[model samples]
Target: MNIPTRSAIFLSLLFHRTVLSLQPPAPRAIVVGAGPVGIAASLVLASRHGYDVTLLESSPETSIQTKYDPTKAFLYNVNARGQTLTKMFPNLHDKLVKRSVESKGFADATITVVPADPNLPIPKSSKLEKSFEMRNNENNEAGNAMPKSEKAVGVGYWIPRHEMVGLMVECIDEHNEKGEGGKISFYTGKECTSVSPRDVGGVFVEVYQADLVVGADGMNSKVRECLSHPRSAVGGWSLDCPKPNYFKLKKWRSPASFLRIKVLQLPPQFEIPDAEGNPPLITNSENIYAIRSIYKGPRNYLSLGLLPMKNNTAVRATNIVTRPDHEVWKLKDGNAIQTWFEKAFPRMNFNGMISNEEWDRFARAEGTRFPHCQYSRGMAVWDENGDSGVALVGDAIHAFPPDIGQGVNAGLMDVVCLDRALSGLDTVTGKEAKSAKENDKPSLGKNLARYQKQHSPEIASLIRLARFGAPYQYRQPHRADRILRTLWTLNVAMRLILNKITFNLVPPTCIILSQRPELTFRQVMRKADLTTLFLKVVVFGLIGLRFRPRLEILSMLKP
Candidate 1:
């Protein structure tokens, strides 16, 4: 029989206490919404950031959407920002790259852009095609645009949105398999009914507890409602966001209703034509075509998009219908409406423009749906206070029409920036531990404030840019839109002239997403504005040079 000595027992207990002290506490993180951004944030926090992650989904599956046409699929555009995020998660990126459709070859040529009035003296559709290309710097501007070591200002990828969600879930599963980060617990179909602060933990969701709560839910997010709603004495916790910061935010919605009609691939005969009238655009290849239809008046407009499936002949057809100051229209009776489709796009392939029959079929297959997007100013990627253990990402904060195809791209960027912010926080709490004493509670809230300040200006600029870019895609009855559209026309004309004169003009400062990965959204906007202003000034100088006598007389007559 062996009995431990009192000294041995005392030494053992002391050693155990020391070991526990040395080990850092695994941060408890709960992510609401298992959508694309939610899943990505979950994996990164668990695997890369080493947080104990819990992912919750309201739906039974990541996406409950069921496709009516076996050939058709949902799609998304992953831009430079999204690509930057992909680089952070190698496994996620690798899987997506393998199965995804690459869009390097896509250009303005893929789509036809015509003036609303055919006789409006605009260039040929070929010349007016808009391509999503990253901008190169005129000088230090280009240098400033590239973030990190990523040098190329490359075009984004166009993969199905559902595929993105599915693949993200798979990547997260794989990360969980390795058990690298604090063990991740994922639950789907279990809705997050309520969220409040716990006495013991920082945040509480239903029965689970966590140090932080990240809400990546989409536009209609319940989690966002909780964050937005004022806390009550009985039910919710107060989020002490400063009053001054509240005034900085501008919230507004486009009252206009939009109708989105999606159809499976065009029949064999209805192929998207190229400039030369070659075989259909999606005949046997995997190229996508995005075209904006020209309407005769300011009342209505449409955007047509065709994306190919990776391994199948089926192409996804999307039609976005916009009429100024109108309510969302629906087709429920399965009545055929081929007349308008034929009139607008007589040259295209198989079926008529979204036939009522097809629309009804889709409605039956999926549920009744309407795509609505609203804009709010000064919404950074993260919520106000990180110390509150609450943060929001993706459509929860800012959701807008895909004017520049940045809906998901912006969301993905949110995760990337948040990841960086958290990484810095980890350093401060560990390697920068001594420095934490200088700033009390230096971990989440302080780093989140840094994120808020650093990222707010850029996201605000993006929101404004999206609003400005809206007229080109959607018809606007507002007088302001009319004026902006006129200015936009002038900008486009000046751009053409400058490119003609300089032999190499900088990319138009349209305030769209940058091609270079490094530049902030605000940086891109500033460069675009500068380019626009330069072009305008140059054009004015040219006018004076050509009409010197008239200008001199006019200047002398001015009172």
Candidate 2:
């Protein structure tokens, strides 16, 4: 009994060694979808936020190939809404900018408002599109209602998606190596069917349970399928006339759809100024620019944007044709490919730019296509399914027309916001050291709820803008909406009137947005939605008058 007191001290020391040496393993995170978004998410979480991550991707060969493939890779535009990474990930941003063609001085997007009549001649001169000097040099110099882009030095940047992807992967890897033993693993060719939901805040991803399952897995996500309601609808997939549900429930619809897209890679010579013995420039501006055309038909329209590739090796153009998916199958033959290109794009010729064999490759190859709008942004960030913490980011939560250039941007933005949301997360172990109870993990409910509340508005805005601007931006407007075209004629007339009144010598035509990086999709979308009837009438009238960009014409009318 007198010797017993020493025994208690030995037991205490034994317990300390056992618990301290084997502390709960760091919370494990599984990221599905190894695209730029998913990779970015994994990088941010591991290198910056310090989370163990395993990234899984479905496509092995397809996603990595960025060669001059008509079917696989296409050009991408990064706008003000997407330029936030410049500050957050400066190294990554700088790397991407270096690989991308500069859109400020060397190249910018020229929104050409062209008359749909095939007979109309496309003006080849660059002077027709106004310049920043021209905008400010007006006699009146009234800047009252002008969009800020007119005053800025640049619009945005364009990079081929594949090249961007490669650069991003490189950046992530380089940065991650410096991390202090951060667990980051990536696997390709893993098409996850369905994952078993865990109880304590992780999922049994093919038997290896993780602490969190993030579905960065695009529109048609099986992880989304796991969280979504069995019977549901989202975007064009559920075009049923009745109301099944809105954002309240998990809704998965039919296979998502996309316009039969035809992408082309032209010789660098394609962008040479036509005024300098070249072909037609999209705008009248003398600066090298990416051309965005809003070709207006009687009832339908098409929005085409083309940009120069890195080192000026090639020019890339994307043609979004609204055809039945079944009809626009793979390339039939070289003649068919040539005929299709000639028919879809009558203005540009690829004869010398691309050989017949190349054209066939362009037409025949199956390119990357996204869903029209497949999965709902439904389900909670951390809901009690079997018992895991499941969340979705990127196209899984919000993907639609892709008009606002929000696909990659939205996903990147989501990662930043989510990281902020889970800043002080406790990283409670799900089942390794705790009870099998769902409540065993530290509460992440409020943190997740706050994330959903704060982020959903932007995503909602994304959906709203995408759908509303779809017809106007590219597809066909309604018969009633077409009346606005007559009004656009008045809009052009007003620009001419103001230019005359102000004693400005510049030609008065339609004006396009400067594609300013500071210009938010929400702001632009709101203005487009609430535009006065008279203004719409004027803007539409200008289009009827063959005035291209309504923004410039409207600014001229600003008192």
Candidate 3:
């Protein structure tokens, strides 16, 4: 029976190979965003899947035309997970690194613990700070003649979002010049107002019809809104809908996960010193300094984190993130905010670092909040005939605070996953295509569903992990809060050590461990939950032991 079955399978495969490959017509895709995720999605669809793409951006053409916009620019730490997309496109990783601050010589970090008294001198530098300084100085002296091994040790790249988008656009233009797989037509200031999931679903940027509509637009996505508040049916047709529609998506809203952020732009080559007020040994771009205070007062001191931009000319963008109701947010004017900065971070030379104009700018800047983390149940919804569909990618489907820095990386991975899910159609022969057509089974709808299934769980795990796992500590003014955070961190470290010593008997949680590129977020979450249970059991056992002695003593007294 096995021999006959194998023979039959071989004969079927041989017959299929003998048939001529019939390429299907390229499907038209309308991607409704020109941000990093949307642009990358366009590249994948056009180059890999041979889909003619129309890229629509709501921002006017002038905004992205410049090399960089300091006021609006923020740095993205593109780690290995986000860099995985480079494998699909040639030389993209190199291009990104060339324009970014590479991790090897430029990614050193220094932390200074400030004294309680504003008049008191800054504390001495720790061993970690000394080592960072040494390495940075060595790199500077060596200049561009660094070793290949050292260069290969780069953990990631720190690139501004606008610059990354510019690089992607360059890739698109190059692909166009060489006549790559499919052509992409880019249009700026074309906002997507509505969508109709009727026959050959259309995106109403300008009433353009397409086989598929991709919602790569940002958090305030119009496509997501369209899905949530679909046109109501009336008299056998949707009056609200500019046209008739068959598919009505179940209304869904993202779970609210909010964090307010204020961005401060500091000048390039600014002199920032150590806790002892000593000038840094290396250029500012090579290191990130965090100035924290020791005082536990009514109002928490500002915990300023300054992340660098590109190597030479880029200015530093400092983020002052806090709860929406934090005391810092209550400061009404620039003078009040400047006073807070001067009081909160005393060791730093604020006079030399930030000018009066800069303070005013920071005050005038209106901070933004992180969007809720959610994915639509109908991420890949289609019409009744299954011939046309709408798919969502990037922030349109899932978003959260950029606390973990996986926001952009996860969005890029979505495009790669979508491409993998739909790649199965390339093997369909003419006979199979005709059979699929006759049977009313277009593979596009099925493939999109497959993508949703494969991608949704990761999205869920990512959101949960980002929202709850190893949150960044801002070192509040309360000593109790600091003590508890320290204990929690030590406990995590202890579990990791135990797992190593006990030969995996005690599984370690994925707190900071979630950043490992080899492990998926789902895998990370599973390990985290299991480790949590193990710790709980150990804690209960210890409690039982401690009480057992007391109980025995009490029994003796009773006797």
Q: Evaluated with lDDT, which candidate comes out highest?
A: 3
Which of 2 and 3 is ahead in lDDT? 3
Please, what are the lDDT tens digits per residue for candidate 3 over residues 316-407?
77777665656677776777877877766665567777778878777877688766554554456555444566778888877776656788
User: Per-prediction count of colliding residue pairs?
Assistant: 11, 29, 0
- Model 1 is weakest, by summed lDDT over 10 consecutive residues, at 135-144
lDDT of candidate 1 over 171-275, digit per residue (tens) = 777877887877778887877767676544477778888877887877776665655545444423334443223423255443322433344334432445444
What's the distance in Å from true for residue 156, model 3? 1.8
Could you arrange the candidates by TM-score from highest to lowest?
3, 1, 2
Q: Name the regions of candidate 1 deviating beyond 4 angstroms.
A: 1-25, 63-74, 105-152, 232-240, 243-249, 252-282, 289-304, 313-315, 324-331, 338-359, 362-388, 425-441, 474-487, 495-507, 531-559
**Could you tell me the TM-score of candidate 2?**
0.65
- What is the lDDT for 370 in model 3? 60
Better of 1 and 2 by lDDT: 1
TM-score of each model, in listed order? 0.70, 0.65, 0.76
Model 3 stretches astray by more than 4 angstroms:
1-25, 65-67, 104-154, 200-206, 230-257, 273-283, 293-298, 325-327, 425-442, 476-491, 539-559
lDDT of 3 at 375: 51
